[model samples]
Target chain A: MRNILILLSFMFILLSCSKEEKEDLPKDPIILPPYNPTYVDLNDRLPSYLPRMDIPADNKTTIEGIELGRALFYEPLLSGDGTQSCGSCHNQSYGFTDNGKKFSTGIDQVEGNRNSMQIINAGLRTSFFWDGRAATLEDQAFGPVTNPIEMHEKWPRAVAKINDISTYREMGYKAFGVVQLDSVLISKAIAQFERSIISGNSKYDRWKKGEYQMTPQEDYGRKLFNKDRDEIRDSLGNVIQVIPGADCFHCHGDLSDFTDNLFHNNGMDEIFTDPGREKVTGNAYDRGKFKVPTLRNIEHTAPYMHDGRFKTLDEVIDHYSDGLVHSATIDPLMKNVDIGGVRLSLSEKAALKAFLLTLSDPDFLDNPDYSEPPPL
Target chain B: MNMNTVSKITAILMLVTSLALTSCSKEEEMGCWPPLDVPGDSANVIMIFNATTNGQPLELLKNFKDPLGRTMQVELLKFYVSNVFVSFNGASTLLKKAALVILVDPNVTDTTKKHNEIALKIPYGNYDRITFSVGLDVVQNAGDPTKYPSAHPLSINQNTYWDAWGKYKFFMIEGKGDWDGDGTLTNIYGYHTGFDECYRSISFEKMLTLDATNSNETLNVNFEVNDVFFGKDTLDMKLHPSWHGDINTIETAFIISDNFQEGLRLN
Candidate 1:
């Protein structure tokens, strides 16, 4: 009888202790290992001539992040319809530019207004989009996904879809230390991958280092392109002054405007239907002004201009040669505005075209690092 | 205690420790991040720059025969408003006193363009007057285009910062007019003003009271495009076809600069 009493007493005491322990314990008791992402130095990835790019401090680039970003960029799951990814418009072989199309067709089969910008040297750019509408790569990333004419996916739905995928969720955890994927982190990863897309090692870059020799035509063309304004008179009885050179350098940059990553009206139209920079600033002076693309890999990035109006390099050169449009906001750099164009001789135009071809970076177009990743 | 009882107690303690550690680890991941939800001061004043011809909203790229009887279409109209100081009963309090630069572009039809509305965060109080500069101040105006980050309002992409002259255009009003009244825009008149001499500051005695109770207050500010041209001192378009950041343009640029005060009306 005493033994049975002892057993009952022990059981009662154990039950009371367990009840107290339940109240004392926390709501969740799963010890997940702390995620400390590995950071990679971005400066190490870029050439010395180019300054280290400005990325958001919050979204620092990491090895895992870049890999996940590559996967997400190639993943069609993020699209509203499963037919497109960032890789759809941005092809790897064409210097990350869409192939010869003026306007890239969106997932909805509707055409976008402007040309799809090449990702080459994008990390070095101060603004994204030809209009300079978005200030950061991350800001630029959010634009295509939700744009009704583009991917057409609502960000929340996209996030929910991303959360449903175990592969992406694992990537998200490894990259951002978050189990639930957020738009901000996804954008950061994509931007980091994009920043890794660098295009140097062009014929022009090698020419600077004396690794390659240009043909006489290419050399003359380069000289003509670098031509600054010279005070001269032509036979039209109109004295043209103020605009000089082949007059390309001022608008283009030191390597000409392409490398400069600046914007200009470039005298494309007298009255602009599409106000390029003006659309972003609402300034009428910015009407018809579009960001000057780098001349690097220009051969691959044809149909040119913000609208992709010019089909070939010759068309672009011809426009600069004589198709200049006088406008209220036409850049004053075209010093010979009275006569309309630079009046390049036929041979000069051909040479300029030859020089432009030298800017194509084959290695950039073929690099496996920038190629589409395996299916996510 | 028996081995079985000891094992049960050990497991309970382990669970409690694990829960505490999990909680700590989650917080540890987020502890370094800047707080996401700190609110900003209310922006009380919403200034809208509207272009109107005789009380009708000015339509861009249209041939408008203004009250001055010149048949012209405003091809472009853009400027900067900066260094604004609010004037109260006796003293003046500067808003964004150091770095307040706002680019005003009234054209909104373009999908790519930024909207013209400016949301200003004025301090909590009452003010009967306001004062501001017509363009970017000297320091912000005169900088290497590459020196500043792209995100800055002053930093630009080659167009605003002219590479030829290496000068920034403060304000621009470009248009074509039929000076002969022949129904054709033969005369291309533009007043692209810049340089330190052209920067003007104007003040208006308009009653405004900003308090805690009132938020999202809007102020209707009219920018008469005509005031920029035809006033007491007028812009003689014939003498000046265009004045874009040239040393010789200082004389013509000042005439347009002085006219800004007359055009700005606080309704």
Candidate 2:
């Protein structure tokens, strides 16, 4: 009986010790305030799934990397003629797309094949360019720099120019651990800065987060956006399901980043014969297809289409409503749908346009970080 | 019974406790449940493609028949097959690792480096049924290329047809076809299909049981190219059917039929 009492006392002591250890475990650290230049407490407000910007294993992002990238992005020395920077085509005031032309002119007044894609919320994009050619923002950065029509500078020369600057040299070394530059390191730094150009503070975003209410017309437009159109038939006279009508979601579907990242021949103009995608594949069937651009800031990034054929959102809507041209390669979903040729009522068009305008993010346009580097 | 006897008993108890603690310390130093030196086994399967017609080895790009039975020269031949899932008694394994590889001049009979194409390492396991598709997944095909390297073949310039569209050529089947009067010159025609609609899924139960033991093994898979074209209903490429570009019509028929299954010969 005395031994049993001793054993029970020892067990009780061990249990108490375990309980104390459990209580002593530390809790997770609380995130501090002043999330950025502003004193906004954003720890609780940020979305959990916001894509973590990819930093190359080789060149990681740092304060110096962002600063150097911003300077290079704004500097004209990146161009072959030393006249245009990436900022020339992607101006902050115009939603990161040039407002002056249908197709932005590059070096020597050479015209690009496609309209300038808007860079608003581009950080969230899974692929860059209408063709989805470049896989990363870094890869896309090298295109305009090297394209004969664009900045027109070879990668080696571009890297050499950046290496010449001591500030950039030091910044590159500090950020990527090398004063000498390469395409990979250059692209990484530029991509890091580009990823920082996030734009989610739109009224639509507010509505999604349940922070704001939509107007009655805007509500109706949203309903139409989700509803399917009437059944349509293809050029071959095959019946096609048209459940979701003028739903932009059919193409530019994702709520946050509007592009679906799929290529389609949306029956813009049948006779143009540009052979948009076919040129890439050499297949007779792939002709006339082009990637659907994002609709996040579609209101500002007009004239639309690969060639900037449509001047206004109304024209684009009209094209979708009643302007569809029958072709062998037209998307099956786009077959004889009453849309692309059907005329929407003026008031309905106005409401739809209003709904599109809600997508414009004021914070992105005014973000100080996205602006030109403050004088040195 | 005296104080000296009590001191000796105390020393024995202390020694026992010290030995128990030392054993435990050694165990801690050895660390976690499983020891570091334990050996684990895995399987690796290599797929080999050889193109042959009848008993003779047929050149993929060079030989083609025209209406008058005339020979035609060809240049390139490539195609895409994705969503490859291997099953052992109806369980899926890592299949996305299978992707497109270009076979330039598949018809060349020279036992040189041209004929050999192999996919990289797949974790070793017993797979009785191996199934693969002729096209990409809808989500994967449509998803932005910026996220992953595998999504965009053009980014690496793996696909030759990278200019007309930014998309990776899902499939490139190029060869010489019979022309009206164009003589012995190589006439290149390619069948490259991609986009969400073009996505095709093919699942087949591999009859051969794969045994992954100590060493890696290669599963020699022989595909008769003609089988893909000659189905229960022979699809004559010369007819130039309107449904060639129509993915919906072709993908449904191709995925369900035994045409793709019969074409696969595993040794």
Candidate 3:
């Protein structure tokens, strides 16, 4: 009986010691499972001629990170209420833009002030947003989640929700090799996913590579789109000859990017309402300027312009044709403004739309890689 | 590893970090580190730009009569101070130079901060002269603020640099003037000074001795409000009510910028 008591005491000590060690395993760096990060490689995928993306050193593209980001992106759990996600506004079917909606509805069903833009080829771009307020994609992700009218969720609560889930911990470890869930790591992962959403495989790209052919009207529109000169003029502002091309290339030029990536006061209105770039840059001269968006996937993305005032491409073409309002801060690129606009005829407007359609890549929109993953 | 081992490792790491920080602090005790240095002990000076009415800090929103008996109330005063070249000796050689541009808003005063404080850390010695440029020199002022990081001093958010005008506003001030002197401040008077022609570098030759024992000083760099309008060329509020970044305000811009140099006093 005495020997039996000593044996039982020895067994109890072993059991208690093992339990204590198990509780403290996470604290012990040596005992924890080695965090093997899934590295993402995209060297061969991107075109050679295009300049390399300026990815932040801290947030390198990782396969696990991008996958986790895409999962977080589609998961409505990130919203204030588990009802809306980034994919809700930026639907993949519409080239990662709003689904023909003028303004996207938030969690509270409140409409946004500006048009939701597609972040295709965003990694190559320097500044983020229409006003270029957010400097980086990582910085830009912080906006919609906390904006009072948008997601309406505080970052602390959003991070806490993701931390509560066991799957996120596993995914976080795979991406960052660190189990700690923070807003910075979350932002970086989302930025990586955004940067990976490249839209360079359009019909126009294939046409440039001599892989496809454009329709007659589409070809005419392409010519007008790249039109830099509107007839040669003398020292005086007189039209020596009536140039019949749409002078749209100056502000929206550079073939591959399809945008100058600069802000312009494109004679939208005579008076300022939503002081676009002027809010970021306090200069009075920049009162009406806004960042020029890329023309890629223009057909899929509708309700054009920053405010989404024009519903269709025809209305947009009409604005540049004759509806341009003269402003004191008008860009010098609006050279034909003396005659009101480019004055594209009825047939010319239709042709411009045809050419814009060639920029849409159906393959990109239907890519399963871009689609939301199956339930975790 | 167990809890005991983890605690031991943390304590060792803390000790190492404490020692490393102490070594760095010892080196920072000297005013100038790495390249620029002088024999004497280094000292720091906290400079303030104040709007004054008869040698006293001028209060905004309070109507005061100027020398011309014009009732005025200074609503806003903002300017940039950069290219701080301090000369210890009477010679052309500069004692120390700080290559930084800082915005100074007199309305918000906390002398320790970047916006309010214009610190000068120079070698402790008696000097015949001290000089600095009031505005960004030609090269420093060049570059689109949009290209720079958002948090930088000369970023577009400050409203100092105008891309359309292609220049930085060296000094800006606004006030309400009662031109008729009926004691009612109705009319607004603004002097938005800038352009390449207005950028001025002023030099003050005064006998200033640095106390080696007490290696710190606070200097009052007063920008007399009246001097900006009345010196050399008086502002014609009737002719130009608001002088913005246009060709119309070039004359007033020159007058106000010229007075900025003449209005200085290192107290």
Candidate 4:
């Protein structure tokens, strides 16, 4: 009887202590090993001429985060039907674009209107999309996944799906120090991976670095590309000698990214088919204007322009040569719009094409790091 | 006293002494200009640069008749302001430590946009005159913009630099005009001025007061677009459609620069 009483007293004291400890426990316990991420230095990856990337403080690049993001980017589990991923549209082999396709087919087998933009040096751009709607890479990544026409998956559903997987939960913990995966963390990881996609090595880049020599034709083409429109006029204001100039340096300046990163009509339309930037700013002056893309991998990113109207590079050059259609919002920099276009001769056209091909970065397309990762 | 109690009292006294010493040092450092005291010697001033046409705030892309009565619409008008100096009692002081370039973009319809506003904090006094350069200094003009931060005004991403010419465009004015007044702006004209020779320094003579009584004050300066096109020298848009900082348009760019310098007035 004495032993039983002693045991009961001990059990009662233990239960009381357990209750007190449970009440003392913190509502949200502090995660151990704190939230320290290994930051990446882009100077080693990017060329010297390219400007420093403006990375967000909140979403600094980390090796762990990039690894998680690369896996997520290739995982078809992000899509509603589990048949598509970001890599489905942005294939590394095709310069991060749909190979030869004008528009990427979504998970619903529906074709998107705008072309899948090549992701080369995308971290340097101020805006995303053809219309410049999304302001940052994070904001851009938040799109597509929930876009009904693209991934066709709701944010809640996507988060639930990701959380269901143990590998992703582990990745989430490693990347963000959080076990509960959400859209914000996912977008940040994807943005870090996208920022890691730096492409500067090209034939032209090699030539600029004195590692490769340009052919005579390519050199002549480069000169024409930089030359200002000079019409040796007679006393009667008529052309006497044609000092042929393609004059492409203004909008597509050759300083760094080969893009001015500004919106332009480019005299491609006479009517409003898709009011590109006007939809965003709601200004009449912005009507028919579209964001100028980088010409880094112009050779691989076929079916060019916002709508991918031109099927070939020759067709694109031809459109700029004589097929300019004027609108009210035509960029004043399009100096040759009144004369149809720049009016490039056959030899000039071929040479310009050759020069554009030099912009193709073979190493970028074959970069194993950018390729889809194996199963997690 | 017991050792434990004595140790606790000693620790408390040490903490108090350290805090007292820290406060004493801070108070001594702040004796000349106390932290609690309101800074009556300095005042904040806002310099507003506005783009106007004939005393009216210019709305971008809106059709307006120039002094020549040519129907024109300005698509873009951006310029850089640097080397600001203020003179008080025959003594001049440079406002900025370095060549701080402020790109004034007057493209917004909203007149209160901060793009064209320059805020300064200076000594509270009556200033006789204010002088400022309308373009970048020689060193800043030649400096590689890629070295600057992305958000910096002199960043390469601003798309104002002329890489081929190896100089920045100090003044960029792009527009279209209907010379015949047929309601169609068919003619395009871009008069971009750059290079060291075209930089203009303008002076405003006025009794500008930045007294303690008026800490937050605003000074409005207007850039007359009509005067720029037809003020000093008439720019024939038909003859010279564009002046893109090339060797062929250097003379015309200089004339345009002079016209721009002549277009400023107290609004």
Task: Give the per-residue lDDT digits (tens) of candidate 1, residues B100-149.
Answer: 22232332333553345555677667788888787667865665555444
True contacts kept of 4: 0.40
Q: What tens digits encode model 2's per-residue C-alpha lDDT throughout B202-252?
A: 554564443454335555656555554464445444332112233334442
B7-69: candidate 3 lDDT, tens digit per residue: 999999999999988865322333221223445577776665666775667765556777788
Question: Model 2, which residues run further than 4 Å from truth?
Answer: A1-46, A49-55, A153-164, A180-184, A232-244, A337-348, B1-267
Worst 10 residues of 1 chain A by lDDT: A19-28
Give me the candidate number with maximum lDDT. 4
Between candidates 1 and 2, the DockQ winner: 1
Question: What interface RMSD does candidate 3 have?
Answer: 13.3
The DockQ figures for the candidates are: 0.04, 0.02, 0.02, 0.32
The runs of at least 3 residues in candidate 4 whose Cα sits more than 4 Å from the true structure, single-residue gaps closed, are A1-36, A232-243, B1-40, B88-90, B97-113, B214-216
Q: Is candidate 2 or candidate 4 better by TM-score?
A: 4
Task: Write model 4 residue lDDT over A1-376, tens digit each, in one string.
Answer: 9976885585445335431222222223223344566878765688877767888888888988998889888878889988888999998987899887999888988888899998988888888998899989999998999888899987766776776676776677678876556788888888889989978899988987999999988988887777656565565767776567787887887365788888888988899889998888887888988989988889899899989999999998898889887789988888778888889999999998899889999999998889998887
Ranking by TM-score: 4, 1, 3, 2
lDDT per residue for candidate 2 within A208-306, as digits (tens), equals 789889998887666555433433457564646533335455456443455545667677765645887666556555567777776766666778888
**TM-score, B chain alone, candidates in order:** 0.74, 0.59, 0.73, 0.77
Count of clashing pairs, candidate 2:
23
